[model samples]
Target: MLKKDKERNDAFLAIGNIANSVKSAIAPYLDGVLIYVREGLSVQSRKRGSVNPVFDCISRLAVAVGQTLSKYMEALLDPIFACDLTPKLTQALVDMGFYIPPVKPTIQERLLDMLSMVLCGEPFKPLGAPQPNTLNSVPIIPKDAKDP
Candidate 1:
């Protein structure tokens, strides 16, 4: 059991630090991906001597997807950084597949699971460990609190 307050704090802090790093890395990396894909397609379009709707559509889609994902990561990381460690750990455990779901997880759920796996070690199987019914089901806390 999570007996020591210090241990809990340390675990939470370490995970928060990981979340912050993820937040820092995601934006630029996403932007770079968009830029690289767009530029490569642009060069190809130029080589072809005519506008390619396929390239244009793909570039637009990349920008839209990047922006959406960036916003979602920011949303996820905010609570991970500031909320009580109890909830964070609970959610992280669920994300890391410590628990089995009654239903299939959504795409966002899968992404969070991957993120949790990266931050935490391997997941405990539901049969091996007591499982939570849901993963990261905590309410979205708005960004009213100061950054740590």
Candidate 2:
């Protein structure tokens, strides 16, 4: 049996962190994860609508893939939308020292703000790739030249 919700949440997070590190490895497994997501969300749907950690893992995976998730939208969108997020969003703002706005912004605004934040980050700098040793490279001499 799956563990309690808290335990399942931690497991979901671990899988999501793996997704963040190796997204290419996640595509083939998307269907499986979607199954869990749908099931988890459905369970949450039957509750009093407390924020669920399955949603957190979904966010993590979405961030890892960006728009690549579009292809799976048909399977994902409904259960996601079926769950109410206002409480979670309000809690997030409160935690961040924000006052809830008089009117909730549309979902597009929230999504755009998230995308903007990501796009505004400092550009990624690659860890330097392997380098061939240069100090040990001897100069090649032309057959006709006395000096290398």
Candidate 3:
């Protein structure tokens, strides 16, 4: 019985770890999807005259796709958390103005509050090795110099 309990615990731990990694990895992609949906809807709304039915249809289609993906991501995360904590975490996100409702919005408001601008304290600096300047670092051989 003890060994069986240990195996069950191990299974739960593995599942939790997988869920955490997936949540971290997919977050950026979901943000990109949200951005795409927002931009597509914005363009559709700016048409001068009666909107083309096809364009509007495509815009709605995009929004639905984005929403479906986002909800799936959330569903994945939900199982990782304790049942009681799930609603609390969601409410916290809502309080921070980061929650997007499941309801579809009019095209004009679809893009609103979807994109957030992040201000970095410092610019990113690449950690690559300093490249040697071939022209300056290498000594030039005279035209008459024989090959070594």
Candidate 4:
């Protein structure tokens, strides 16, 4: 039981770390957007309607945060694939009617991919592979050689 508890705690901690990193990266941007939206709404004095622009902006931000959190959780939980709980969590989110957006490749995707590659001991597929070195690539003359 203690071993199981430790494993669960470790998993939660790992997820928490990823969440914190993402939140720290995005919080400032979200805050700025919120302030901008609020000021715009106040200045325009737009009447509240079926589609609340302010709420929509807030909802978008919340969705972004939620998606980021889920991606991090998925990456952390991936090691224990057999015991994967991401699907369940995703389903729960859907059932709760949360605004779960489609998965789009972002910086988070790249980071998680790199992390997965490192953890799996797999070779990274660089965006552009470097040209192979050849004999001609090396300096033909010694560094000490001077102009004849």
Taking every candidate in turn, the Cα RMSD to the unseen true structure, in Å, is 24.4, 18.1, 21.0, 17.4
lDDT, each prediction: 0.37, 0.56, 0.33, 0.39
Candidate 3, residues 1-148, lDDT tens digits: the string is 1124344334333433443445444444555443432332243332322212212322232233434444533332222122222343333233222223443232113122222112343333335947657888888878866766
Q: lDDT tens string, model 2, 10-127?
A: 7676767887788656867877886776776675433723335666666666656554555665565556555545554334233222221221243334444444556765333335
Which number leads on TM-score?
2
lDDT at position 32, candidate 1? 43
Worst 10 residues of 4 by lDDT: 76-85
lDDT, candidate 1, equals 0.37
Candidate 1: segments with Cα more than 4 A from true spot: 1-59, 62-105, 123-129, 132-148
Off by over 4 Å in 2: 1-3, 44-51, 87-148
State every prediction's TM-score relative to the real structure.
0.18, 0.52, 0.18, 0.24
What is the per-residue lDDT of model 4 for residues 1-148, given as tens digits with 9 covering 90 to 100?
1124344334334433443456546654544443443442342323321113233333334444755433333332232222212443334233213533443233235444555665776644566878568988877866656656
CA lDDT, candidate 3, residue 97: 27
In every candidate, how many clashes are there? 0, 0, 0, 0
Q: Per-residue lDDT of 1-148 in model 1, one digit per residue for the tens?
A: 1234455334334433443445434444454443432333343433543223222322233232333443333323333323223432344424422222221144245445555666675532444665565657666778866775
